[model samples]
Target chain A: MIVARTGNEAMAEAMRQVNPDVVAAYPITPATEIVQIFSSFVHDGLVDTKFVAVESEHSAMSACIGAAAAGARVMTGTASQGLALMHEMLFIAAALRLPIVLCVVNRSLSAPINIHCDHSDTLASRDSGWIQIYTENSQEAYDSVIQAVKISERALLPVMVTIDGFIISHGMERIDILDDREVREYLGEPPKRPNLLDIDKPITMGPLDLQDYFFEHKRSEIEGMNTSLPHIEAVAREYKERFGRYYPVIDTYRIDDAEVAVMAMGSAAGTAKVVVDRMREKGKKVGLIRMRVVRPFPKNYLKELIQGFAAVGIMDRSDTLSTLGGHLYVETRAVLYRASHQPPIKNYIYGLGGRDISLEEIEEIFEEVLEIGKSGKVTEPVVYKGVRE
Target chain B: MPSLKELIKKQDLLSGGHRACAGCGATIIVRQVLLAAQYPVVVGASTGCLEVVTTIFPYTAWKVPFIHSAFENVAATIAGVETGYRALKEKGKIKEEIRFIAFGGDGGTYDIGLQALSGAIERGHRMLYICYNNQAYMNTGIQRSSATPYCAHTTTSPAGKVIPGKPQFRKDLTEIVIAHDIPYAAQASLAYWNDLTKKVQKALEVDGPSFINVLSVCPLGWGVPSDMTVEIARLAVETCFWPLYEYENGKYIINRKPREKKPIEEFLKKQNRFRHIFRHPDRDKIIARIQKEIDRRWERLLKRAG
Candidate 1:
């Protein structure tokens, strides 16, 4: 069905259709409406989800872990500090191999305590062993959440699907949603594993692994992430076949024939694409690579994608605070180290703490990259874009 | 209620040869609770003595379904499991009736896990939460916990020249849980196996959340011989240091009222943790204070039971 809905509404609508067996959540801003709306759905009997109005985000994630371990299709929504609060359990969920689908509306972390759009919150948790998929807008947010369920289950890894806070969460846009029956059919039955609830064949979960087997167990977990790309691609392909839209881990726009390309994620990719189109109309060879899945790093795809570009500019909405540039810049730079012909990649840290990154600013970045592309010379590897010095 | 023979004959869900120390009261409590459980059960243990000893990787003491997900969240975790079971059962995916139980040490219950326990109880998940109250953080080598009794010397709240021992009284967690207005909440002792198992059965039979705080004895942490675990626990009940009581259907019930409550020293003198108080210059004063507190609490319970 075609409907005009906010990103939060879209995610909630998808959650309703997914009709998860359990959803334990605590509310936080920007992501609050998703659970609020879903809880109302539960009250109205629109879905059979067991909604737990937990007291805190820590319990919310902890509950999700428990439900997931109990062999139920489980999901929850949180953002910013809520995600930060769920930090420890996030690693445990991944380690336990429980495929919990977490919907994250991207927002800034605290210091000055801002509840605004930024990648800092999710970016800080990049090493938490969760499969992170950044969405460009409400439509993608709606689609990615459903896809995340399948990907997470297929790969036996928890998936974090994020849309920019307020920009997409509170902003309304036209999005096509799958019918409830279609979603039900697409997902089929919740995948079965040796769960905690199995009465006869009893199993022990989250056992204390000392030095003897902790390393081997962690190695297997790493291997789970390593070989998960195929599982991700398989689900995306199946979703495309079932529905008309398709989303890849590395989403590219006009990057095939461009001399200068820019990398962006979440909503910034939308603005970058508009600039890419505008620059293309004026005969500027510029392109965009939107990172959908950040964890497991998409190393091979990234390597293949950046092969021919003369110069690439990476747009990061959150700074690493390490003076080592942003997360994407450092990761993308590292991924290109083994490339035969390396591009002079510059990092543009922009739109931090919900600050807007204008198309004109993106155009300016493309212009700089285009200059570097033509000159075959590099300068200023990291620039804090759109913020006054 | 089932007789001791009948209860023991039902099932031995906890396998033998676990790594728990000798006379660990937490394991005894676990066995009683699991044996009393009528339906198919899934158990959760917090990161404490019971969890570490029972669920070491590749070897588990549990013969029934078990999960140990970090300390301080076992209540929340079991709430989720119960909810999950409900959802699955409603969906026709799960057929059998399954009871959920979470076992947390006092440190995981009265201290760090207090919030999660409160939340779980308030939400009223149909699960039984048991706190093995062994006084201190026994799993972490006798650190001070809110559950540790006043004048008991733990590693963190050690008795010194300037200070007596743990300055504050132990948290009344059973009363705190009762404040949540849950259907069943109780205090039990391992010395009274029948009472402990009966309370577990009562808790598991409740349609809403239930909690039982068992007086678990740790020989190593409490500075007692392994053989004195049950005897020391009995002394606690006999002296009114740990009352045997329950809150059910909005009424308080003192399960066992001693004919003549003994002095607190009978319980305290047996353990080295309280030895400093017996030898201190203010020994009479400290002992009087401890006895007064217990008397005050017991009187309050008697009034509530009326």
Candidate 2:
């Protein structure tokens, strides 16, 4: 059924349906409502969850790691600073291979301490070994939470489902939700593992993997990440068959015959989509490719998709602080270097610290893409859009 | 209470063939704590002596479900597992009666992990938190931790040209845990095995949060002979440097009060950690000061116990 809810509300509803055994979280703005809403559901006795209101994001994630290690379906929520606080434990959670679903209301990291939307929060954790997914709106936020649970459990990897702060987080949209029974049946009893809270068969979880074995475990993660593509597609296929909704790893719009395209992730992708359609109506050969699953980053598929285009502009919401472009742009360029087609890619760093990326700015980005297509060379490699340089 | 025969006959949960140094007080605490536990247990340890030494790649010392996560969150981790147990038990998922316990060294417990332990106890989770108080960061090469006693020469708190080692008084972590007003909190040592084992039994059976701080000795860190570990811990107790007591539900009870408290020098002289203090220009004055601190703290314990 369709219901009007904020991204936080939709995510909370999805969490309710998923009805994990444990939720350990701390309140951080933008992301606070997700846990706050979940707390209310717990208070009402709607879900039999042991809600742990931890002191900090470190404790929140630690509790999740513990609960998840104890053979319970665990979940938590955080934002920029909260995720930052959870940084150390995030690596531990992934290395331990616990399927803890972390709902991140994506916000900018702190220096001057701004609590606004940016990819800096989750983007900073690209190497954290979590299966990261970004949603464009409340609908995708709701679906992504449920999908993340199944995907994390099936892959034996933690997942971070991100919704842009205030943009989609506080904003309302019509979300299509599945029945509680349907969602419960979809995530039936969590798949059992050899390492769990079983008394009969005891095992050690998260041992010190130093010099001799650390690399082998990391190699196993590489193997797990490589194996995730088929699992992601399989989950999505099952989700579509069961719920009548499709979620592509890297979603594309009007890119079939386009010579110029703009690639982005998160809520900004929606605005970029609008620009793509608007330019399409004006008979401009421009399109959009938005990434949903940013981690276990769809390398082969993204290369194949973008290789067809002559020129591409990558919209990065977070700065990498390097001479090389932003994190996503760098990864994209690295992958495309191996592809048959070498498109001249322009990197646009925009919407940092929650600055709105207007449609006009997106149109300008498409125009630049078209120019790069005709020029066959990227003169300006990096553009800090909408910011005073 | 289990008979001595039964306790001895109980299968050792922490197996042999681990890498802990010989005469390690912390490892003894683990073995005794596991023995005291009445039911099957799941354990979690912080990244310190117990964790690193217990598990490496293909081998693990634990026969129980042991989880080791980061340095500062053993309490939080065990609380989570306990919370999970409660949820699953409520849902009729966990059929057997299982207990939860957490282990950490002084570095993990008194310094880095204090906040997490505080949070876990404050939440009233059903788990026993055991701090194997080695008095310093033993695993990291004898660095100073909050639990490092005054005038003790650790690696970071070396007694150098101008000063004594660890000028500050050791933090009373047991009292800190008691401040959280958890269901049960206590202090014991390997010196008093009966007292420690009984406290462990009591803590394991508590329905809510329980904490036990054991002043375990570190031969390497304390610069004592490995064979003298238990004797030094005993001297620490006899000298009243480490009191044996329990605080449960707002009531303070001294478990063992020595009739004649030994001089603090009896404990100090057992280890080379305090050797430099004895060689100071004002050696007598320094010893008097250390004794005074120990005596004052002992008097406070008496006042609380009464």
- Cα RMSD for candidates in order: 1.2, 1.1
Q: Could you give me the TM-score of model 2 versus the true structure? A: 0.99
Worst 10 residues of 2 chain A by lDDT: A25-34
Query: Where does candidate 1 stray beyond 4 Å?
Result: A29-31
lDDT of 2 by residue, B213-276 (tens): 9989888888888998899988888889888999987999988788999998888887888999
Each candidate's clash count: 0, 0
User: DockQ for all models, in order?
Assistant: 0.82, 0.82
For candidate 1, give the lDDT of residue A135.
92
TM-score, chain B, model 2, is 0.98
**Per-residue CA lDDT of candidate 1, range B196-258, in tens?**
878988988899999999999999999999999999999999998999999999999999999
On lDDT, the candidate that comes out on top is 1
Global Cα lDDT for candidate 2: 0.89
The recovered share of true contacts, given per candidate in order, is 0.72, 0.76
Model 1 chain A lowest lDDT segment of ten: A27-36
